[model samples]
Target: MRYLIYICFLISFTINSQESIDAALINSTDIKIDQIVALDNFETFYYLQDNILYKQNKDGTSINYSNYQLGEMSTANAFNSLKINLFYQDFNLVIILDNRLAEIFKIDFNTAQPYKNVSYVSTGFDNTLWVFNIDFQQLELYDYKTNKTRFSAIPVQSIVLSLESDYNYCWLLTENYLYQYNYFGSMISKIENTGFTQISKSNGHLILKKEDTLYFKHKKKEDILPINLPKLLINQFLLTNETLYIYDLEKLHKYQLKIN
Candidate 1:
């Protein structure tokens, strides 16, 4: 009996001494974080408002140039090279913007059904644009070429709430599920967990929030590592390089990670 007690004590000590693991923090020099962009006294009014995409320069002024909610203002490709916007009033309006937030081009939806529902919008690689239509309970992709719209076949049945696209893949979050779709709109994999308030991707990994817990996962991992967070309501999250920017609807916080 005494021997068994001694062995158990040693085991407990070993377990307690083990180090916790987290995502590796890239070097600060290697991971340059831009200054925090603060837009004061701007409240989001529309439940389904267009992207008031603006760029904050080194001086912290966001040069604004949206059509003043003239139409359904959809996706904001702020990080993309072209920074395009998908606008549809009665027809699909693709508005191109420069870095200064100036309007460049406006392409009207020229189809038999000019007034189709654009549920979601995102940018694609090779200067392509992704248009998500939610008509007849289906999601279709429309690739915008230089001056024309080509219908692509990427079907969706779930209700997409927010979406983001990159050169190779796309990340979409519905009411209760999160999906990773390729550029062609084919579902690669999906995770069904509710209360996913916001998501951001960088360096092939994604950072999301479920309730008050912040979770991080790589591209192919099936499980997520929960990060330590206080009891504060988080409305959105943005991950860049290795830093996680948390927006709590009232303030922003920065987190540095250390993987062991």
Candidate 2:
């Protein structure tokens, strides 16, 4: 009996150790960060949709122009310093904004046979965009810099809620489920939760908000903890460093949490 009890303790400790997030802050003071322009890392910044990218710092700022516009943004692979956006006027365009959210290049679809009537729409991922031609009838992947199809596949017609990309994973959210894909556009995993309304990733953890409650899951843990949240409906959330920033309507709320 004693042996069995000892074994059980080991297992539980291992599980707890493996499934935790180190909450760095909680209920921190809320600061009114303005213009926002664009926010990336501790340095690069962008504001207003313009041809210029802004180099930002705690004490200084500067701007440089790119040939294209930043459509969608990717914050995960920070080293790539890439931004993806779509534009279609005379041609189907997919623009890549640099890490600094400045300087741009585009992929032109007007010259391609398969690209006729194609429009580039942005998913939530930075450096990633969704290519749909003819009213969501066809969907494909558009890489920002190469301005080419990284992979092409048909999307199930549904109301999409959000999209995001990490260095190795791409996440797509619909009303009923969350589908995770690899950089090559292959399906990796799917989680079904009809109550899911919005999601955000910071650092390496995923924070999902359903109804009025916020839930945090670190890696593959099958359990969820009900975290306290405000009365406002979350417009969006961003996980930066170890801080959780919740955007409600026009205001932003910051929370500190320990994952472990």
Candidate 3:
């Protein structure tokens, strides 16, 4: 694991640089959302409202799913568009949804053998899930079919803030640190979070956001570059592929993330 430190321009929590990257405004859409939920690669918007999960597509079509019995949806992972994982942390339950928003299956952690008190979950490779078992203080590659743990990472005593994973890697973000682990349960890199509040992966790169500035971390690069962005009210934001979506609760602004 390596730590790379760069000259971070911290002037009142905003990156001030003449050679800053440009975020070209592409389009704007008016949507009523508390926060920016997620905008998929296909330009589909996924939003959770009043216990119902809505999928609004670009073709003027939408679908929704809801289960009041499970309580509110804690999070929705649309990493795998074909199979979406909707987790309800309150009841430790997960509902898998198909592309058409149809319920495929449900995973109840309460009745699960071995009894894992999972606090976080995300889509994983080949019918598996990246589950953060709070009881064990570790992240596990869990296979729901066999109800077995494929691989478990080392325990972290700190509170896990966010978890993002691809097929080969799982990234765990804590209060002051961000860790990357491989499928073999090996820790790859441990980078200080440096005031970051959220984690989003797009095109094999990480787009880290703080208060008003956004940082970029390419997969092959060790340095974290601050994305030069204009000051705007960002209640929530999503960096998907070449586009960046910023929502101020009432409208969604789409921009192209052009890195210098």
**Each candidate's lDDT (Cα)?**
0.57, 0.56, 0.81
Which candidate do you rate higher for lDDT, 2 or 3? 3
User: Model 1 over residues 1-260: C-alpha lDDT tens digits?
Assistant: 99999999998886545443254333221112222222212321111123344454545454555566565454455545355464544445677666555776665555424445565667666656666666654444554444434444445566666766667777777776777768666778878856776676775687777667778776756666676655655555666666665655555566666532
**Candidate with the greatest lDDT versus the true structure:** 3
Regarding lDDT, does 1 or 2 come out ahead?
Answer: 1
What's model 1's lDDT at 115? 48
lDDT of 2: 0.56
User: What TM-score, to 2 decimals, does candidate 2 have?
Assistant: 0.66
TM-scores of all candidate predictions against the true structure:
0.68, 0.66, 0.87
Highest TM-score, which number? Answer: 3
The residue ranges of model 1 lying beyond 4 angstroms of the native Cα positions read 1-53, 69-75, 86-92, 110-115, 146-155, 194-197
lDDT of 2 by residue, 121-211 (tens): 5443555565555545444666645556677655656666665555666566677667766667787777886687766665446778787
Error of 1 at 227 (Å): 2.2
lDDT tens per residue, model 3, 1-260 = 12222334244235334344567888888888654457876778888788788889999799988889888789888778778999999999899999898989889889999888999898788889999999989989888888888888888878888888877788888876899887776889999878887777876678777878877777876677777666777777777887878787777888897753
Give the better candidate number (1 or 3) by lDDT.
3
Model 2, which residues run further than 4 Å from truth?
Answer: 1-55, 60-92, 99-101, 109-113, 116-139, 143-148, 222-224, 230-233, 249-251
